[model samples]
Target: MGKNYFEDLFEKAFVYIHYDENVESCIFRASCWLKEANELYSSSQWMSSYILYLRVFKLVYIIPQRFRISKNASYYNDLLQIQKNTIQLTERLTTLQKRIAVMHAFTPIELSHVLQLANHHDPSTIFLNIYAHNSSKEYSFSSGTVFLDASFIQNNSLDAIRTVIKTPHQAHIKTAICYSCDNMLDDANIASKIYLSLLAMGITPRFLDLNSPAKVGKNTISISPVGLTNLGNSCYMNSILQCCFACSPFVSLFIDGQALRSLNQNNPLGTGGKLTTAFTSLSHQVRALQGQGVCSPKDFLANVCSIYSEFDTASQHDAQEFLNFFLDSLHEDLNSSAGKAPLPELTTEQQAAKERLPMSHLANIEWNIYKRRNSSPIADLFFGQLASQIKCLTCQRTSTTFAPFSSLALPIKDTTTSCTLETCISAFSMQEVLQGNNAWHCPKCDVPRDAKKTMSVSRLPSVLIFQLKRFRMIGTTHRKIETSLEFKKRISSGMIVPPSFQSSIYYEPVDYELFAFVNHYGDLENGHYTATVFHNYDWYYCDDAIVQPVTDFKRIYQNFSTAYILFYQKVDAAN
Candidate 1:
């Protein structure tokens, strides 16, 4: 029902990344190779696999030299590196990826860390890299890696009217064609653009500006997060992480998906401790919201607002715990030579909107909660400045508060590899029983002449996140009880329920039937620059309460298209 077409593309990426089918043989052969080499003295050595591994090392040398920011460099270079790193690392694993040999038991914390890394891999990194590239030229991802600036976007990509226009205002934002991704026009961003175009037409009998409480507009801007407004407290972090999880249901490598599959070899449990805490908080609040005796729609609205107020307050409270971390991350950059310029207070209307909320308690809790924020290398990367470090929440080991802190993310970042399934199996499977058969010498796996064991090869499973761009909540304008199902049935039915490792669960479906965003462009932030669109760069995830669909890399552009058209033609992408 949601972006079914992206399945093919996701499979392609998975196959390329995991190098499925023969990974087991490779592990086995490496194990055998080392065993044989050790068994034979210096007088008799079989270094064929080791020699072949050295050949893989050549791949490492070859890539960084060819790393250029040129035409079509991202997908290919990234894919190639992913492949090369897999070969190199797999060859190095002491267990050779054998399930029997690899340890079956792992501590919860240990499991959490590995799952976190496995889920938070390069695809997200690559997607963010491209986003930073499009928003501003000054912000490079490599620099972001070094600097940790989360706010940087390429400012210059939009400065000139560099693109060749096919038509003028005739092409509404909803149905714009992007040459990227082979010009697939049937996308969520395109759908949202159509809806946006309807609004822009002024032909509709009803339309109004969201900025005004009365709803009036000659022009309208979708007030999400962008520009100067930091969603008070750690709402920014919570909201973004929530959006990522909501958008990417196919994501099994994450902590939540531990219910579905074990992505980490060592970890039986999934990701960080965040999901459990967040879910517990959300559940309790939702239950209390339902208990209110409703007299009318006003009562219902009152209830919702109450729940939202409390939820956000709680969220902010949790966020404050990390303020020391966030602040430490930014302080160094704030003091840097480049940062000596007056650091402008980035503000937008949302902050002002917070002032109008009816709940005084929530208002008090909002900004006061995350009053302290430090810098990260990521933040510095965005701002072209250096940030200070914070304490590691996991180890409590104090070094620099930086994310790449020695005690925090150990072993740091590593490369990955990929190759054709057939080629990998064929090249590596060349061994026979040590006693007697004519074999070229199996470099991937070796079996004892008489060992008793059973083996099974199932689909090596993994996932990529894809976002649903046109998806929207249905009842925000009117506080109506939209569902007919009872609460028990809803829970049991897995309706909008986040899936677990063993359970095949789903959450509330995107209210796609009621909304559509057909448009000339789709960008993540839902902005427009007077009708200028950046094609492939349009779909970037914008964080707030509204959930999106499709985090898959292929469909991210659709988000770009929606955001591009809305921002450029209606609002302001530059803002």
Candidate 2:
């Protein structure tokens, strides 16, 4: 019998599976490779080809490295052969495109893996030979395979999920993006680069910001170059499923071995300005990705090696190290600083670049700190007493202590008196989310008439800012407020620093008679400015956050932490 579809492409892969010792292993790898290869043949895009190459390349490189096997020479040799085949196929297709004659370029080297039949350039050879041949159809959650639904994936949440999925135990899922232009049209440059990289990994790469997507609704982001209908049943098609991959030090795939090398060699992070900030932020994000459950550190390294195989191993190592260091920052907010040990003395490196090094400080910040929920009926958890005000009893005994949502590690003042957030809420918000006309109200806490703070804490939120030169994130999530990838061009695109509208980049007072009267009267008319109608009155109110009881301490704790992390990080970083 002839070899299978995948086996034909990788002739020497028999040893990878140890057909002589473990037939099942060999068959499984062969089956996987076969399915992957056929998927490549069925597509005309290079994106899929790149992915397929990485998929096969990983295992091909791994076996030789770990086992010191003789498969090294053969694997590269096989790659050369496949490259040769690909070139020949391209030539054939090109010829067919021009010629008005019948032709056959794909040689029938193996039978259908599913039907035990010969090839005919149809789905039979591709699908049957690989996917169908593998009889195992059922999937368990615990299974190693990451069956990511590609259609409805949220382009915005891609980075978050990438981080979560890489949480040591999870498998890498293929994300899909818009196969449109290279978003290099100016402000779209950065976003375009992100999408292009995602294309190779199957992440959603599109040029649209999908806010408020629903499970079933009419909200479809018209950003797809190929239209949504072509996405079929893939979860990535739904507008509600977009996960943005606009990476900063605080976003995207972290712990990339290759990235570490490049960052150290060429771009030593934390130089100030936008470029340095972006790289440092990117490192943090990639590190967080490593913490996710989707992809493992090993897998990430392997993928890097395969796709960026041309780079020297040392460069790759630097890239990975840098990636890990940046990710380490995201392990928790680089700020917050809950621990109580004094910071170590500055090292030589730290001292040499003391000015260049990042510093932590508490700046202009407003928070809505709340007590732990006294009761949570929804999750079936309960609490007794909830403190109304935050306390730090040890303040009297400890030295002058400060908690300014720091970037570097610092010790808490003292153990006896903790700086814990008490019962009341102290929430802050972004201006972007405040643009809507209707005021968000919550019956339990704040309606339009209730506490303004509560109303401002909850409701519709802005995750990121839409700027050209820089991307800012909402709250402090230690992530970007708005996805830079949403835009196509970079600084050149004018989106970051769009053409200045001389009319109002700052404040715009409402039209009122009070202003007219003020002009008629003297400066401050009499003792105080007379109010005709209180013309410059503030009218906007944010969404209300109804404080519920904390039934589950852990859940509520995590929720609080998530919010606090972002809030303080933003506040401190800004300072």
Candidate 3:
């Protein structure tokens, strides 16, 4: 077949499928084509099966557009089934092509081309056949074809292939396997180098045990905790960076190269994605170190300083302030709604209706409005809504406003020598009287009057951060609160959300697990910051260039007086 054979076939199929045809007739034709395609697939006729599948998909695509089939209709399901079969068959054909290209006689450049094509689409699985080679004899080591995740191979093609090729052999034995193309000598030497380098770097690929037939190749790479080399007085930045890296979901987006797609270079509020690019490069370097050595964040710091001039100096800063700016900058860089028009203002009637809606619905509406302007992974994971209600003393009317917050700042009472986190949260959500200069201007009564203000968490983020207000100005002197604040490893949303808004706002019970926290020592003016993070089911204290495992929770709990910022991640309800 010619190189353009599939393209030509698809074009002709589209031309033949009548868009004006009846919905039932088109569905029937698609169903028949799908049946034949499945048969051809079963018989291993990939080319013919893919052709029929493409044609069926083309027919099914126009059914809804031309006839507008109702989703509840019986034929709608049939059309859906046909479309699913076609999609599955298309993926199978693509995988088959990749396998054939890999197994056949091909050069390094040819294999690279095949891999490039395979990278465009995601395949469910790929098979690797491993054989053991020794001085005496050579034989198949794997019982059968070994299954591997196609995405893993797509990302780390050479490393994955090397791992699979070296899985069954002992370290002392020199093995040569012709897994790809006819250039066995060159490929084998390359694979050997990769395997040795991987071992030296402490990245052992996970593979199925030969004794376990049902197990599949996971290709899991272990990441070690690599310390950051601090540039003078950069402990505050380093501590926050360590905590951000501890976030699996946030770091994976950069480590896996998925954040690049969402990078908004055109955003005026952002650093033209320069910060995100620098951060991604830093993440790669951190992973490459594999805990064997320290990684310098000079490049990332340079990028940060270019945007925010305050961090350019060699002076210690507040970790919480840096964290807020860092998250906000990343959010702007990756904001999906960058340069997009804001949502129109709601009509008066709509506003009244919105006020009448339930708290959940109102929160969703507010969130949608916020997302239209500030949509990003950072917002999705770290942002939550705070509801503030103000009751007018004169008019006896109340108004509620919803605002977004990245972190909750809780105030510590000076009278308490020892306090619990719940007490702080309750203090944060409690109501207060507003009078004198803080009196509210009543819009309905047209006068300034004393009012009562209440605050509550209306929405919860997947990851939550709490900043303890330890530093306060006491009569023009900066003083630090040395009160011990005790907290648990896990906390429920009920502790943060008010009792009145619990059932109405959150339908399901939400829980948060403490993963990381920043601690400050010494006075507020000249303090050192260190972070303790939970990674891989173990706790580690990260102090700038030093990373150490913490086995004793009692010792860590005793030093809670210096804890400044707490990080929590929402537990998956399904898990």
Each prediction's whole-model lDDT (CA): 0.24, 0.23, 0.67
Scored by Cα lDDT, where does model 1 land?
A: 0.24
The TM-score ranking, best first, is 3, 1, 2
Q: How many residue pairs in model 3 have overlapping backbones?
A: 0
- Candidate 3 structure quality by residue, lDDT tens digits, 1-575: 24564465455333133323456666766776777767765654444455566667766666666675688887777777777776666566565444323222221112222233235431321223233333212322223334333333434656555565444423533222223222222233333443353445344422222221112221122345678887988889988988888887788778877678899888899888888899999988888986667888999999999999899647788899899888888899999888878777777566646655545456767877788899898888999999887888877666678999999999987765788889889889888999999999876677888999988898889899999998999897889888888757888776686544442312234568898899999886678989988876688888888998889987578655568999999863211
Per-candidate TM-scores read: 0.17, 0.17, 0.62
lDDT of 3: 0.67
Reference-based lDDT, residue 195, model 3: 39
Q: Which residue window of length 10 is worst by lDDT in model 2?
A: 511-520
Q: Count the backbone clashes (under 3 Å) in each candidate.
A: 119, 113, 0
lDDT of 1 at 528: 19
Ten-residue segment with the worst summed lDDT in candidate 1?
Answer: 484-493
The reply for model 3, stretches above 4 Å from the true place, is 1-223, 346-353, 504-506
Q: Residues 28-52, candidate 2, lDDT per residue (tens digit)?
A: 3434554565554354322223333
Best by TM-score: 3
